[model samples]
Target: MKPVDEYFINQKEPYQSIMLYVRGLILNTLPEAEEKFSYKIPFYNCHNKPMVYLNILKGKDYVDVCFVQGILLEKKFPILRNDNKRKQVRSIQLKNLEDLDHENFIALLHEASHVLSHSKKAWFI
Candidate 1:
C-alpha cells in the first residue's frame, strides 16, 4: 500500500477516522492536489507548491490540518489556530470527527489552493 494510505491505516481510532475524513474532503475539494508522504506525514501539494499537511503530534489528542500559507489565510480564516506561533503555518485541530466543519474545511482547502496558485514565495517541500 502507499505510505500515505498506511499512515491513515496505522493510526488508532478517532485519529484515523478524522484523518481519513479530512483527506477525503481535501481530495474532493482540490482534485488536482498531489498527495505525498513527507516529514513522515501526509502532505498535499497544490499548484506544484506545498499547500497543506496532516499529522497527529506526539502526545496530542487531535489531528492537525495545517495550511502552508496560513499566514495569508489567517486573516480570513480566524478559525485557524496559531497556538504554536508558527509564522507561516496555521492549523485547525480536530479532536474528534464531530469537531470537523465539513463546509468550512472545504472552503479553507480551496482558499489555500487559490493562495498557492497566486503566490510567488518560492516555497519548498
Candidate 2:
C-alpha cells in the first residue's frame, strides 16, 4: 500500500472513521488538492500552497484537520483551536462524527485556498 494509505489503514476505530470522513470532506471541497505524505502525515497541496493536513494527536482521541493558512481564516470561523503559540496554522479537532460541521468546514477550505492562491510569500513546503 502507499505510505499515505497505510497511515489511514493503521488507525483504530473512531479515529479511522473520523479521518476518512474529514479526508473526504477536504477532497470533495477542493478537487484540485494533491494528496501526499509529508511530515509523516496526510498533507494536501492546493493552489500551489500547503493547504491542509490530517493527523491524530498523540494520546488524544481526536483527529486534527489542520489548515496551513488558518490564521487568515480563523476570524471568520472562531471554532478553530486558537493557539497563540501557533502563528499560522490552526486546526479543528474532530473527536466524533457529530463534530463535523460540513458547511463551515467547506467554507474554511475554500477561503484558505483563496488566500493561499493570492499570497505572495514563497511556498514554504
Candidate 3:
C-alpha cells in the first residue's frame, strides 16, 4: 500500500487523535478487519466487503467515517446520523475525537459486526 499521507502522519492535535480513537474503536469490535487502501484512504474489510473507510481531506474540519451500515442498526440504536442521500451508509463526522461518544460508537460497531455476520451466514442458505 502507498504510504499514508504525511499530513495524516504529522497530524497531532484533533485529526490524529480522532483517527486513533476511531481506529482503535473500529478494529477492536470488528472481528475480520484487514487494512487496505481504497481510493487513497484507509479502509477496513471483512470477507471482501467494506466495513469502515476513513478519510481526512485537506483543510477540512472533519474526518469522515464511512462503511456505516447505519440503516441496519438504527432500529436498535437510533443515534447514527441519518442523511437523505441513502439509507445503507451513514457517516459520523468529527471535528475532534473528544466530540465522539466512544461507548456509543463501540456499541454501534459491535452491532454492525453482528449484522454482517448474520447476513453472511444467511447468504449460504
Note the Cα lDDT for every prediction shown. 0.88, 0.84, 0.68
Kindly list the per-residue Cα lDDT of model 1 for residues 17-107, writing each as its tens digit: 9999888888888999999999999999988888999988888889999998888888898989988878788999999988888788888
> For this target, which candidate reaches the highest lDDT against the unseen true structure?
1
- Predict model 1's lDDT versus the native: 0.88
Model 2 accuracy (lDDT, Cα)? 0.84
The TM-score ranking, best first, is: 1, 2, 3
lDDT of 2 by residue, 38-82 (tens): 899999988666888997878777888888878777899898885
lDDT of 3 by residue, 5-95 (tens): 4535766677787886787777777757776766777777766666667876576688877645666767776655554375476677788
Specify the poorest-scoring 10-residue window by lDDT in model 3.
Answer: 116-125
CA RMSD, predictions in order: 1.7, 2.0, 4.1
